[model samples]
Target chain A: MVTLIQRILRGNPTLFFVYVILFVFFVFAASTAPQFRTVYNISNLLRQAVAFGIVGIGQTIVILSGGIDLSVGSLISLAACLTSGIMIGNPTLVFPIVFLVLGIGVLVGLTNGTLVAYLRVPPFIATLAMSAILQGSVLLYTKKPVGGVTRGFMFFANGQLGAIPFAFVFWVILLSFFLFLLRRTGLGLHVYAIGGNQEIARLSGIRVSVAKVAVYVISGFMAALTGLFLASRLGIGDPLMGQGFELESITAVLIGGTSLAGGKGGIEGTIAGVLIIALINNILNLLGVSGFWQWIIKGIVVIVVVAAYKVKE
Target chain B: MLVALFVVAGIVSPIFYRPQNIFNVLQQASALGVVSVGQTLVILSGGIDLSIASIMATSCVFAAALMAGKNSMVIPITLFCLAIGALAGFLNGIITTRRNAPPFIVTLGTALIFQGIRFVYTKGAPFGSIPSWLRFLGRGGIGFVPASVIIFLFLALVMEAILQRSAYGRKIYAVGDNKVAALYSGINVPNIILSVYALSGIFAAFGGLVLAGYLGFGDNWAGKGYELDAIAAVVVGGTSLAGGEGGMGGTVVGVLLITILSNIVLLAGLPYQFQQIVKGLVVAAAVIFYSFVKVSGERR
Candidate 1:
């Protein structure tokens, strides 16, 4: 037991620190707030984290690849609106719409990838433009909430598997798959190499453009999945649903010890980061703190946490 | 390119040539134009200020709440707002430089904090109005040209001259071009970066003041999307995002182009959504076009 504990402590100090913080906060919240300790609220907290976690995974990949995607939030809005608009409460149309939305997500990602890789556009500018385009398109499609999903279609987010929410379960599967890919696959190594030093990576014969493009596609696909989950949970397509998510996801990734400079972090820290945010949000809500204060707290936390990492370095 | 856009706009709408419409576009351009000037400095120094919009909003609200449409309160409040803007930028600069954190994330975090402050201060319902003198800055004109336009053009020319001739401006370029080299050359890189951010904050605040005066009221969402717009304008104008390679002259043209494009869209009676789409396409296209020109120039 001592050796096992020591191994974890030595393996990834950042990850251990994050989990420790999450645990301490969790215990503090549970002790202080009776509602927070309840199984119902705990499960609800997990549900709330699902959307952020899903998009955060994609953000992690992009950041790991030394790029950022400002378009995920807009893409989520588009996906949600498109999913419900096409479904329109029809159970029969669910699968087709899901596929369609996911396809569009991939297409958008491909465009971003091409711009960043082939055209050599800065990821910041490329993604920002893509975000604007997506946002405008969504608004043109519908300024307000439009269309609804059938009750049966809600299972994507609301269903239960044993004691676990389906969305949570889905998130775990994704987390595991990405973990395996990053830890075990050649593509993952290439991602790190590209991020660490693009010129060197190119000299080493790594398919730099392909890897860059792939990360964006992965980000896009995950954002679409988040959109689907959100649509299912809400039962309607909201044009404004995905607001603030791009920054929020980046916040999670940064807090998780993922360096914005790239090639130095993992998805495991991201999960803890997502949990920490959800926990704070839940705790603050239980404490009757207004959302405005929450925003202030969140902003401070991001700076303080990143600064702490810098201090450690 | 500016002339081409003008020709196209005139062809699309006969009213585009009207002096009244031209001045209207210039007046509308002033706020964003001012904000873009700040963004240009930061970008030139190899940093981005995502917090500018929030700073702008905070300035707008703070000015309105303090001035409260009183002519007597204008000078002090305006100075106070600019100081506050500088302080906010100083905070951004401190964290980003000292911690070596990405300006993108740091400024983003600061943006939220600033936005939260605005919300908490106003309690979600901001009240107050601009004074008439300040209103002249935003909406009033000297004959055909708007006062705001005059301020914008003057600022642009001064900034351009500074970029070309001033040692401080040259230091900004050196830091942006190569921080390590600049440091080796005995430049106080951090101080330069810090000062640049502070300048950005002041400019953003000034932009906010203009916006408030034009609107005649305090609004929570007044500067909602100006950060991106300013960035778009600066980059579209031909300032390289890579830093140290572009200048105020290009940014001025960029601001004008963006404002005119939007004006055309409005004049053509297209939906606001189309304006957004076109804006996105233009940013992307402009970047692409600039890079293409650069690549060809390099090859030659």
Candidate 2:
């Protein structure tokens, strides 16, 4: 057991922190709240996890490329704003409408990629500008929340298959596919190479720019899916719904053990990280910690985790 | 040419430079300008402080609670906010300098954490009433020169003197432009990074104070999107996002340009949402065009 533990810690910079947090939260939850142990709460946690878990995948991809994309949350908000108010509720449009929402996501991602990849504009500036554009565009589309998405849309957000929420299933399947792609393919290798060292990757014949654009495209697609689920579940999509999800997604990715400087992250780590964050939120709420301190504690956790990694390095 | 555009804007709408509206713009812009000033320093040091919005919001809540709570404890909270801001900035430095964490990611992570901290303060709603005196700082002017603008002017001069004449400032530029060369020349890169974040924090806290003063009432929502505005203003003002180019003057112009653009939007009676769209377009255009110009200049 000691050797195995040492192996895990040696392999992952964030393993120790994640272990401590997960173990503590589990113990606390089990001891203090008997209700937390039930299958119902476990499913509920999975359900909550799926929402951010999906978005966290995209954020990890982008961050793994040595860049941060602030525009994902805005993209989610815009996708929600576009789909929820009219199409799902109108009953007039076909699946073509969902295509339109997804199409919009691609366009947004493409714009970000083109500017950053082609124009030599910094990723931070390009995404930040795009976020502002999406935020405004969403406001223009709907001043407030719109209540409607096709009844069929609910299948993605709240439906259950053999007791598992469809959302959780979708989240898992999506993540598994990406995990495979990350480890088994040339695309994954290129992404890691670029993130680890862009200049060397360029020297090594990797199309560093293309990988970056691809990352944002993946980010945009996931954000769109996240928005779709929220719309399906809430039965209403507010233009402002995605205001903080960007940070949340990024935090989950970081907590999952991905290096911020890029090139050294994986989807598998993010899964654990997402679970850690989701569990932390649940435990904190259960502990009756005020919302204010919830933030303080969350910040402290991220700092400690990252700081620990730094010290270890 | 940009100066002439400003001239034309003033002519297109007399309100563009009206004393009252100008005061309003200056007061409203002070907080962002303060944060941008800090960002300018960091960017020059080849770093970016993405947490300015969070730092500003944290300070905003701290100041609001003080003024509204009217507790003699206001000073400590203010200092506390300032100290916290510096620590946050210093933390960014430590990650970047010691752990060799990239400033971009360090600040980005801290920014996310800071957002949560701000959310906790209000949980949704901000605290405290704008004291009359503080409110005056936000809305009133002294002898026709607004207090916020005066503070902005004072800050600009101080920043200018430091950036141009101070050895510390010279070291920052050297570190930013090329760290390896600077290190060979005996510059302490990590210490410079540390001081940059500290100064950035100080400036950001000052901006938060101006924000609290001008805008009465505090909530977790304060400075929701100011970081983008700041980066936009900083970049538009001709400060290179690449670092080692431009200074406080460029940021001032950037702030002024955004101010004019917003004033024109309001003058047109367009919805505020449109203002955001316009800001987005303007930032993209400015950055893209500025780079285009720089490239052409290089070719020349």
Candidate 3:
């Protein structure tokens, strides 16, 4: 048993850290916040994690490909603004609006991917600029809160089958799909290969540029999905709905054990990281900790997690 | 590019060179100039500091909380703010160097933590008055020159000298260009990295103090978006983001250009949103242009 535990840590230190922190956080929450382990609160926590977890999955992909996307949050905002403005509670407009929002995501992801892969712009600057552009565009779209989410659309977020939230179900499906893709597919192999060494991967004929673009497109899709669900959940279009999710998602990815340098993480780690964050957020809320200290604690977590990873390395 | 911008601005709005407007530009550039110098050093070391704006905000908040409008408290408050900034930077530096964490993530984390602490301390709205003398530093001028501008000039000169002539300057470049090579040459690479982050933190605090003085009030969000502005200046100044290939001279030019561009945008009567879009595009253009130039130069 000792050897197995030692081997597990040796093989995947990130997993060890994530799960250990997650368990400890759970225990702490259970001990400190009486309502924290209640079923309703647990459901609410899972729901809260869904949007970010989806975006975190996208971030996981981008990071795995040796790139980072700072535009996810803005992308989420843009998606929410556009879809909410266009849908306006019309059941007929739902399909078209969703498609259009997802299409915008594609265009954005392509722009970022092209800049990085073809024009050789650094991923950080490219995505950061993209973020600014998206933010600006959202502002231009509307300065006021947009409303008109149809009951059907709201159901996507609020409706649950049996004991499960629809959003959680969506999250699970996306998670399983990505997990399968990452662990059992040729595309996944290429992603890891490219991140491991682009030059070598390119020499080995792995279509590095295409893979890079594809990953960003996936990330964009995920951000859009998150935004769409967020708008529906709120039942109104908020231009700032996903204002800080980019950092949060990235934090989740990093905490999940993904390397910023790329090619060294997976979805499971990201989910663990997300759950841990959500749980802590839940506990903090239960404890009535002010929002300011929450920010401080989160920042500390990101740094400490990364530092731990660095030390382990 | 600087000259071209000046020429264009002159063509479009001769007011761009009006003495008062020029002073305004210089004054505006002054705050950014201080921040960019620190940014230049960090970029030179092949790392970036996203926490700069937060550090500035934290310093401003601390100054407000400590000085409480007392003239005599100014010196002590300022010193305390600088110390806090250095401490924040020290945390950043130690984690980044010892743990081998990427600078971007480390700084981003620090930025959030600091911003959060300031918000918690101030409860979202910061309140306090600046000391009269410090306000003079931010808003007052000595003999027709803004004191802030003069401070900026002095800082520019000193930092330029350090970057161009000092042994430590050479070490910074060496460490940035290749850490392993520097280590092989027996330089303390981690120490250099730590010092750069610390210096950046100190300057960010200094910039925050000036900004607070200029505004004559404490604002938790005073330093919002300044990080990008500083970065834009550094990039425009021709400092390679990849590190080891730029200096304060170019950053000064960059700061002037950015200040001028924003001034023009404002004068053009565009909404604030467009200003952001333009800045984003300008950064993208400058980065692409630099890469293109580097590529063609290499090929030749």
Candidate 4:
């Protein structure tokens, strides 16, 4: 056990550091807040973490490919609003809406990819513009919560298997798939290469543009999925549902040991990062802290963690 | 592009060309124009300040809260607000440079922090009103041109000269052009970045004050979307997001272009949604155009 721990410490200090923090915080929360230790609250926490977890996974991929996606949050808002707006609590409409939202996601991702890869627009500005466009479109559609999901759709968010939320299970499945892709695929290697050095990646014959586009596409799909799940859980689509999520997902990715500059880090630590944020939020909620404080805390945490990573370097 | 935009605006609505309306547009552009100047400086240093909007909101509210409609409190409160802005920028700079964190992430984090501070300070309901003197600075005209416009134009010219003629300005371009080269050349890269951010913050605070004066009241969302607008203007003005190229001249034109576009939209009574969509399109289109220009230029 000692040797195993030492290997992990030496190989992936960021992963180890994050896990240790998560473990300690978990223990503290469980010990101090009886509510936190309760089965219902634990399940609730997992459900809450699902949004960040799913989106952070996508964000991780994009960052690893040397780009960022500010459009994810707006995409989520559009997806959620569209899902419920079209479904209108009708079971028959659910599947169609799902495909439609996913298609829009893909299209938006493609636009972002083309702009960044082909036009050479900076990722920050490209995604930021996409975000604005989506936000405006959503606002034009509806400024308030509109439409509701069918009862069957709620299973995606609220269904459980032996006390574990179905959303958590779905997230784990997606996580496993991405982990496999990143650790054992050519595309994954190309992504890392592109992020490490775009010029070198191209010279080395990697389809850098294709890989960049693919990561963004994946990010878009994941964001759309999150929107669907959120709409199901809330039972209604809210135009403002996805606000601040872009920053939240980025914060989670950064905390998970992913470098914002790209080419280093993986999805493995993102889960812990998601949990850390969810756990912090849960503890604060249980302690009767206002939500405003969470923003301040999250901001400080991001800087401190990134700075610590810098120190390590 | 400016002339073409103006012609388009005139065709869209004759009201756009009225002297009174034109001054109104200039006044509206003043705050954003000032903020974009700061944003221009930061971007020139190869750094972005996402926190400027948050800083503006914080300073706006802080200024109003302190001034509380008292003339005697104006100078002190104004100084304090500028200090707050500088402090926020310093934090952003320190984290970005010293900690080796990306400016994008650092500014984003500080944006959240400053926003949270604003919320905490006001408990979500900001109060207080701008004094008459400041209000005049925002709204009152010195004959044909608005005072705010004059301030904006004067600052732009001064900054233009500084960028064109000063050692500090040359250092900014040097640092942005190539950090390692700048370091080897004995330029203090980190200090340059730090001071640039501080200057950006000070400008943002001044812009916030102008905005507060115009509105005559404190608002938590005072500069909510100004960061994007500032960026859009800066980029549209021909400043490269990659850093080291572009100037205040292009920025001024960009600011005027954006302001006029919005003014035309307002004159035509278009919905707010259209304005946002157009803003997004403008940013994307400008960047794409610039990239093509750069690529073709390189080919030559």
Clash counts for the predictions, in order: 0, 9, 1, 0
Using DockQ as the measure, name the better of candidate 1 and candidate 2. Answer: 1
Looking at model 1 chain A, report the run of 10 residues with the lowest lDDT sum: A304-313
After superposition, which runs of candidate 4 have C-alpha atoms over 4 Å from their true positions?
A311-313
For candidate 3 chain B, the 10 contiguous residues with the lowest summed lDDT are B267-276
Top TM-score model = 4
* TM-score values for chain B across all models: 0.97, 0.91, 0.96, 0.98
Every candidate's DockQ is 0.60, 0.45, 0.63, 0.62
Regions of model 1 farther than 4 Å from truth: A311-313
DockQ category of candidate 4: medium
Per-candidate TM-scores read 0.98, 0.90, 0.96, 0.98
What lDDT tens digits, residue by residue, belong to model 2 across residues B39-130?
88888888888778778877888788666756465567668778978988888888778877656556766766676766665666777765
Report the C-alpha lDDT of model 3 over B1-300, residue by residue, as the tens digit: 788998888887888888788877888888888988999999999898989999998888878877989999998889999998898889889999999988888898899999998898889988888889988888888766899989987898899899889999999999888888989999999999999999999999999999988888888987777888888899988888888888999998988888899888876777777766777787888888899999999999
Model with the higher DockQ, candidate 1 or 3: 3
**True lDDT of residue A233, candidate 4:** 90
Chain B TM-score of predicted candidate 4 relative to the true chain B: 0.98
Ranking of all candidate structures by their TM-score, best first: 4, 1, 3, 2
Docking category of candidate 1: medium
Model 3, position B169, has a per-residue lDDT of 94
lDDT of 2 by residue, A1-313 (tens): 9998888778874656666777787788889987788888878788778878988998888888877788988888888877876675666663766788788877788788888877888887788888898898888888888768877776778788998888888888898899987888888888899888899999999998888888888888888888887888787788888876886787788777788778876887788788878887877776788776766676666556666556222
DockQ of 1: 0.60
Tens-digit lDDT track for model 1 on A47-108?
88998999999999999999999999999999999999989998889889999999988998
How do the residues A222-291 of candidate 4 rate in per-residue lDDT, one tens digit apiece? 8998899899899988988998889889888888988877899999989999999999889989999876
Per-residue lDDT of model 1, residues B119-145, tens digit only: 999999988889999999999998998
